[model samples]
Target: MIIMWKNDITKEIEKKRLKIRKDEDLFETVEEVFDTRTLMALYRIINKGIISEMRGVVKSGKESRVYWAKDKNDNDIAVKIYLTSSMEFRKSIFQYIQGDPRFKVVKDYRKMIYTWAQKEYKNLQIAYEVNVSVPKPIYVYENILVMEFIGENGVPAPLLKDLSVINIELFNQIIDAIKKLYNKAKIIHADLSEYNIMVRNNKIYIIDFGQAVTIEHPMSYEFLLRDIKNIVRFFRKNGIDVPDDEVIIKWIKEV
Candidate 1:
């Protein structure tokens, strides 16, 4: 009976896989990463009417893959799926998870990945609610997260690192976002850099919040300082005049 149930699930996923394979961009990724469990989680999200269709891969990384998808209204959305089999991901996320007060660390590796996805969704929710420039989180289940897509069609916005022109206004906007995130949300974006910031039509959106932590974390200050340094370094390198890291940190922490 158990074997029959498992086969049924596999057959269902295979049917969906055939449909997804029609998109050449998503075909390789679906085959590469969509294990039975991950596919099941995604299937559940689709069944819930949150995701109407899965399109192409927008971003691929060691820990997760972001796909360009559409909602029931045909609006573009991003689907981030964390790789459950990534042992290295477990080690890298431990520091942030250990210090975060919101979550309890789990020994089960798959469970930890789910926690990480949930953490990112919660962090995005907190930041968005505080009016910080971030992807508006829609839903999260197991290792999958659904959010507003920051780009048009299937193409993602240019990263800050890819931009040719940098101006003080852009720099100030990011700093203000950081300040809002720190003061209003009371969370630190532990990993902030040019690579994770998206620029589109003069607007900026910060992405990837899996490692963010609350201000109550033991290493929160250090993480905050690091985030500040990263932004300052990137702006300064682009010939934009920015304040010292210490000055920015002081301002962000101020009420």
Candidate 2:
């Protein structure tokens, strides 16, 4: 896990933008590409032995920014650093995070994100332990998470929604895998849509577990059903045969 760094990319980035204020949360205060604290965290990771350099920014979502980084062994890594400077961003994830047992005591937004980041790291570890196809987690600190890069070279794998290959067999495998994730792992990939599952080298790698909650948690059944709905819907759109309820039933009863 990357902890800290000596370089200051934030200052360099600041130099590029002359009109912006130099506040600590400058990244969040403005409509800039990234938050100041988050960029510093990336620099810290690089200055330390955790990562060599920041390759480039990949996706900047509402809560976090994902970047490609190189590790000491010259292997590519994906770093998801959350922005704690924005309460608005924090508000977005609260609904999915509020009921989790781990974050029952979290009160502040930053603290909530810290807990969420930790939860994702733990979820990834659990999936790996259960032999679930997922990115191997490397390190997590503050609201930052580092993991093995999912795509080959410097490019990221496209979401399953954009690509289709083979037949219902592989699609069935995805269904079976989701069932195993529920039955064996006792967790739901809450955001289990075509956008979250990646198909690479004809194998499926499930990404983004930040919203995954236990089956016993409140609204778990709803989330699981939605996942089944999305899985079935996407595959069906690709010309596969099977009803959503049939896939749901198979997942619940026999997978």
Q: What overall lDDT goes with each candidate model? A: 0.89, 0.76
Show model 1 residue runs off by greater than 4 Å: 1-29
**Candidate 1: residue pairs that collide:** none
The deviation in Å at residue 127 for candidate 1 is 0.4
Model 2 clashing residue pairs (backbone): 1-139, 4-44, 5-44, 27-35
Error in Å for residue 123 of model 1:
0.3
Per-residue CA lDDT of model 1 for 32-89, tens digit only, reads 6768888878878988999988888888888888999999999999999999888789
Candidate topping lDDT: 1
Lowest lDDT block of 10, candidate 2: 22-31
* Residue-wise C-alpha lDDT for candidate 2, range 1-255, written one tens digit per residue: 654354556666667565344333333332365556656665576567787656667787766778777889999999887777666766668877876776684677667788888888988888878888889999887788999898978788877887747467667667776777787887888998888887778778898888898777798888888888888787777888876666465646563
Give stretches of model 2 more than 4 Å off.
1-33, 85-88, 164-166, 253-255
For each candidate, what TM-score against the reference? Answer: 0.89, 0.80
